[model samples]
Target: MRSLVLEDFGRLTLHHEEEPHPPAGCVAVAVAYSGICGTDIHGYTGSNGRRRSGQVMGHEASGVVLSTAADVVGVSIGDRVVINPLVGCGACGACLRGQAQQCPDQSVIGVTPSSPGAYADVVIVPAGNLVALPAALSLRLAALVEPLAVAVHAIELGRPQRGEVVAVLGGGPIGQSVVLALSVLEPQARVLISEPNADRRRLCTDLGALPFDPGSTGAGAPTDLVIDAVGHPATYAAALSTTRRGSRTVVIGLHSQQVTIDAFALTTGERSLHGSYCYTPTDLRRAVDVLTTRPQQAATLVSTVVSPEESAATFDWLASPAPPAGKVLICFTDTNEPVAAHR
Candidate 1:
């Protein structure tokens, strides 16, 4: 088996490795399509942490189950599925309360060592994390369920009502997902996206969102809800200013660096800002359904795909300060086909 591993900070490579076997309660998936997530980029650049010599580097993934334990009742061998990467300690207070992502003992598969990741030919995931992919869903498209779940969680946190105006302040994968989920759920709401990238700006427009350049105009109009998808210091400030008095703002993006928000703004206008993290199983189910049902929109979200051998260069391109688009898929199957090779 061949796998892409983060050898160290600023380095990734494709190398031959052994395929994993299913453990007592685990399942082994022959990865078909895996996404190069923003977190993977952060891991590579040492933003998350210095890579542990050879760790598999993928979490957003969909694949066919090569094998599963007999105890796994709902799913079986050869079943196509999408992985919900967060693994929680079911005994914790948060987990007991059904908030697994916030559990003190929770750990992500690709980020933490207790579970390896999807970059390999065979990746082992707990049976609990597997969600069966719908028949109509493309394997490539189904891989997007994780990020879409993140967006769905954000919308639920903000609780935006119909007819309200909302602004999403980033055009990356998570930001795009926020726009998609919000638009689909609240059809009447006015959705705007603040993105500096031209290609991503166009994508936002194509997805039925009003694209605004944050650098030029900070959403000249008052918004009812603001989703900070970038979570950078500057965008945090913009998120505060874009919303109207008493409006709610949701912070969904992961910010590793220090970010400052004006305390006066929060107190003066009665504006509330909420932090949203990973979603529950319910959000994953909804995200999977949408990805399967809407093939056209799913195809548009994916900007590029690369084979395992090409993952290093492609990932480097994606990890740069400016990426062309939000989603980049990496196919682990031995097809030797580049996603945009024909172009």
Candidate 2:
């Protein structure tokens, strides 16, 4: 079997590995497609890989189940499915509170805590993490469920009302997903995007958003809700200041450093800043529902598809600032499984 291993920081090599088998309560899946995400790129270039070497590096993926352990329930072999990347104990306080992303004992796929991930010919996941995909959904686009769930969680946290003005900062997959989710939920909301990439700006327009280049111009007028997909510390202040008083600003992107904000401003205006991380099962269910139930819309957002051999190069391109039309997918060349992009 072919698997992509993060041999070290700044290096990802494809190598042969034994086929994986399902353990008790787990299922073995033949990965059909996996998408390279920001977190994967971070592990590739940052300190994560150096500290946790040789981690199997993919999480956003979809595949067909080859087999399942005796204890695995709910899904069967030959089912097409998308893997939910979070592996958390369901009995914790956070889990009980529906905040599983904050579970004290959570482990994520492709990260330090979980076993090898979907950037392989075969991977095993707890049966519960497998969300069955609709037969009509292509494997390539189905892989986007993970990232799309993150955006869904962000919108869930923000709780925007229909017709409210919303701003999405950043134009990456997650950011674009936010735009799509918001548009779908609130068709009347004035959705705007702050992205510097010309290609991404065009994508925003295609999704029915007004584009504002943050680096070149001020984030248009104050928006009722602002979703910061680019959570870099440097951009926090600008994002915070551009929001309407009493409105909400959702922080969905990961920032590595301490970010300074106007505490006094927030206090005075009674505005709120909320941080949204990973998704729960409900979020995943909603994402899958949206993708499978609306294949046409899903296809429009899937821009590129590549073979596993091209996955590494795609990550490099995503890491560097490039024009992004939509999500880039890595698909198995030999499968009849659905690929999200146009033919």
Candidate 3:
């Protein structure tokens, strides 16, 4: 098995190692395409404390099943699927409510060093983490299901109504996915994306969203709903400043560990603020459903695809001042064909 291992902080090296065999209650997936998330870039650059040296860092992924252990009944060989990655103890209340991120015992496959992620030819995951993809969705597009699930979960939390003034702070993968999700759920809402980068703002506009550059101009009119995809202190303040007296604010970004927020902002406005992490089981299903039903908007999220050998340069470029406007995928397999059917 060829795997891209993080040799150290700010370094990624591809190594040829023996393939891992799935133990009981697990399955091995032949990874097709894995998306490099902003979190992955931060981890690669050693900004976020989550990623460690010599770890295989990947979570957003899609592939075909290679083999399943004896006890794994639902997943099987040749099944095209997207990995959920988040795992929690089944007996916990959070897990019972399908909110694994809140579980104290939760650990993600790619983020946690103990479990290797999808940055290789094959990855081993528990049987329950695999979410089967539809026959119509291509494997490349299926790689986006994980991030899109995050967007879907945030949207559900915000519960923004139609014709409401909706604003998203960052126009990256999650923000783009939020725009697409809103297009489906709240088409009548006036969606505005605040991004400084020209390319990213244009891409948001292309997705039928209005662009508001906060770099040149101050935060726009106060909105009814604000989805802050950039989790910095400034964006946090902007989220509060831009919301009316009574509004909904959903935070989906993991950029910063902490933000200094004023108590008066929430009290003065009577605003409801919620922190959204990973998706629920229902949100994951909705993400896959949206991907299957709306192929065009979902397909536009992918910007580039490269092979495993290009891992180092790709990670470096992604961490640089200017990354691609859309999602950058690393393909582990030779055949990047669409999964037309899976029995």
Candidate 4:
């Protein structure tokens, strides 16, 4: 099997490795499409400390089940499925409470060095983590379910009310997904995205969001809810300042920078700030439903598809000051042939 390995910070190399077999209660999937996520880019640049060198770092993927262990149920050989990369200690307090995403002993597939991820010809995972895709959904599009689930979880935490205005800071894939989730989850609410990149701003506008350059947008009426998907000090401050009194703000981006906030204003305004992490199984299922039903909207977010051999170059491009704005799908199989036939 061919796998893309993170040799070091800002470096990716292709290596031939032995194929993995399914463990008990698990299945082996021949990866068809893997999405190059922002987190992957962060890991490649050593910006995020979660990933390390020598790890096969990719979690957003969809493929066909090549084989399944005898103990596995519900999922069988040849089933088309999307992988949920978050694996939690089932006995943890958070897991017992149905909050696997918050489990203290959680290990994300690609982020954790112990668990080789989907950036390969084949990958193995527990059967419980596989979500069957609808026959009509393409594998390339199904690779997006993971990030869309993140947006779904963020929306759940922010809890925007109908007729309220929602502002999303950052126009990256996650930010754009948040805008799309808002459009689907709360159709009546107005969606606004603050982005610096003109291409990203235009993409947001195309997705039914009102795009604005945060630097130029003067202090106007505060929004009802603001989600900071950028996760920088500046964006965090903007999120707090642009949120209306008594409104909520959700932080989903991962940044190591320290931020200072006005404690007095926060106390007097009766505002709420929440940090959203990965999503629950229910949220993942909901994301699958959204992607299946709203294919056109979901497809618009995919900027381009590249092969595993070209992924290193793609990562290099993403490390640029201003990379192309949208999701990049990595096709592991032959581009001319469909890896899994649609039912």
Off by over 4 Å in 2: 47-51, 213-221, 321-325, 337-343
Quantify all predictions' global Cα lDDT against the true fold: 0.81, 0.78, 0.87, 0.87
Best by lDDT: 3
The lDDT-based order of candidates, best leading, equals: 3, 4, 1, 2
> How well does each candidate superpose onto the true structure, as a TM-score?
0.93, 0.91, 0.95, 0.95
Model 1 lDDT per residue over 300-327, tens place: 8998888888888887887767676868
Point out where model 4 deviates above 4 Å. 213-219, 335-343
Residue-by-residue lDDT tens digits, candidate 3, 1-343: 8999998999899999988888999988889999999988988988888899988989999888888787889776888888989999888998898788899998898899998999998888899988988888888889999998999989999998978989999999899999988888778999999888888888888888898754444656778998999888888888887788999899999778878897798988899889999898788888888888779878888899999999899999999898999999999875555333222
Mark the 10 consecutive residues where model 1 has the least summed lDDT. 334-343
Per-residue lDDT of candidate 4, residues 1-343 (tens digit): 8999999999999999788888898888889899998889989999878789999999998988888887887876778889999999999889888799889899988889999999998888899899988888888889999999999999999998989988999899999888888878888988889888889888888889986545565745678898989788888777767777898889998874567876666678898889999999988888888888778988989999998889899999998986888999998866246455211
Q: Candidate 3: where are CA atoms >4 Å away?
A: 213-221, 336-343
RMSD of each: 4.3, 3.8, 2.4, 2.3
Which 10-residue span in candidate 2 carries the lowest summed lDDT? Answer: 334-343
